[model samples]
Target: MKTKRVMIASEEVEYDIIRSSRRTVALYIRPGGSLLIRAPWYVPAYVLLKFVESKAPWISRHRDKLKEIRPDQPSTMINAGDKIPFMGRELTVRAHENSRNGIYVIEDEIHVSVYGALTPEKITAFIDNWYLKEARNYFAERTQELVRLHGNILPVPSSVSIRKMKRRWGTCRSNGAILFNRELIKKDKELIDSVIIHELCHLVHHNHGKEFYALLESIIPDYRQRRRNLRNL
Candidate 1:
């Protein structure tokens, strides 16, 4: 394997080149945004560079999508001035000592009022609770809206629930239950809708066969572009 770098659309992209007895050249964006190219041993370096350049648009799109869906680093400590992601934007955190213990949002800041000592743990707890409450209401409403908009083609989920999932945005069980990851609240509604619609399609077709995607595309024609990370799931 040889590592090479090229400028695609003015962006520097580093890719690994693996040559074998394979008959064709292929490009892939591996997990974490690494690029890989496979080609026959007889292919020249210039030819490979041209091939990578030809795929500039596809490369750029997938890389940008990967960045959008990348997992954020968990906060070890929460403090005033810390930024928190909500609905695809960052909101600054403002901690205050007050007689009432509560949380509210004003403009671009999340105001946390604590009656007792203001600690990182307290702030984290308050923020997590707020996210969960908001996610529960938002996901449920959106799921219902999508189902109604799609008419009878989509099945109504028996129940809609929210939890913290490590690897998935949502899941549709064979029993008709749909569960969404509470962390999904951090993403924009477009991506959220894609997950909801994907699960809803699963209600009609349990597996990811051609029939399932056919139904999904009928509902969200641009689903692949909207939910790039979902393709892997």
Candidate 2:
């Protein structure tokens, strides 16, 4: 990888390059604070440097945004005062007396009555289980409809699965198994459907080439708007 160092905000920063044919130079910070600079394949080093200088403010702002969106909840443990997002709302974790019910979904909270002592690790595990169960049921039915509509043209096999992925919302596996992001259940139903269609279309054309986009447009005329809306999630 081609790499270089530049100064930003009085700090000297080094970044790796991924040269592409795209006209713009994009910069991003990784979780470890390392920066990445993707520039036009044939752009000169001086030109790329100028682009980076012009976008320093925007880059700094976006880096902060990424940090804000990072989910620290995954490692957090559940307890009496732990706050969690149940459905779309935030709820404080409350442990009540153990009931016949393994987990209870109250008006706007998750009431977990444990038979024994509670730990943060256990709480996080229980919450993840709850999310997986609900997500599997929700995404399974939605994926089926998209398959029914376009399964014939799918390049891979027809089975589908839904998962919770931190980086991507959906992916079409080479084996024809379509995996959807479980977190999508938190979004509106229409946006969920758009994500489903987007991944399903990928089964027909693997790459985002002209033909792939054409196929997607034919299936979903308003895809661009739905896509833009989904990104707001």
Candidate 3:
């Protein structure tokens, strides 16, 4: 991976370039306004730079939108009354001290009960662990349902796994395995399903070519809209 700078729309944009064995040139604007370009190893540097220059307007628009939606500095500490994003809704965090440690959600609040003094670290850990468990169960069941619903067009995944990923919502490996970012569990089901369907389509079409998107559109007619909604998040 190499970092490069380019002039896009008169703005000096810095981006990371990662060349892989993959066959396509893909651009990703990650959260917090970072730019990443994934290209085939055979593509020349000049070609990649020209490609970035060509997408100047798109880069500028999406980058500005991302910066606007994302906070300049997100707080790292979790405290009572703090709002947490869950299933596309902001749920208030409520802390309690009890004889036993436990956590649950009620309506729009996450009630966290700790056996001892409440600390920011403990609260963060409890919430993260809870999200992980929920992501595993939710993604597994939902993936199965989607596969069953679209069995004629979708392929059953070799396996489904979840983890915290910085830049990707979900990915489909060459071996037919699907891995989803645990953070996706924070989004609404519609966005989650969009990612699942996108990866499931990959099981049939391994690349992001015309046929792949054609299949995707056949299943989710508004996938483009879903992607736009997700980028806003």
- Top candidate by lDDT: 3
RMSD of 2: 16.6
**TM-score for all models, in order of appearance:** 0.65, 0.54, 0.67
How many clashes (backbone N, Cα, C below 3 Å) per candidate? 0, 1, 0
Give a tens-digit lDDT track for model 3, residues 139-199: 9999999999999999899999997788999999999999999999999889999999999
> How far off is residue 97 in model 1, in Å?
1.0
lDDT of 1 by residue, 16-56 (tens): 66554569999987655667787876788799989888889
Write out the backbone clash pairs for model 2: 77-120
Candidate 2 per-residue C-alpha lDDT over 35-149 given as tens digits, one digit per residue, 9 for 90 to 100: 6676775777688778778878876766665644543445446677767754456777766644221565776677765434455644555566667777788788767766777
Cα lDDT over the full model 1: 0.82
RMSD, candidate 1, Å: 18.7
The worst-scoring run of ten residues by lDDT in candidate 3 lies at 66-75
- Output the better candidate (1/3) by TM-score: 3
TM-score for candidate 1, please give it.
0.65
Clashes of 1: 0
Regions of model 3 farther than 4 Å from truth: 1-75
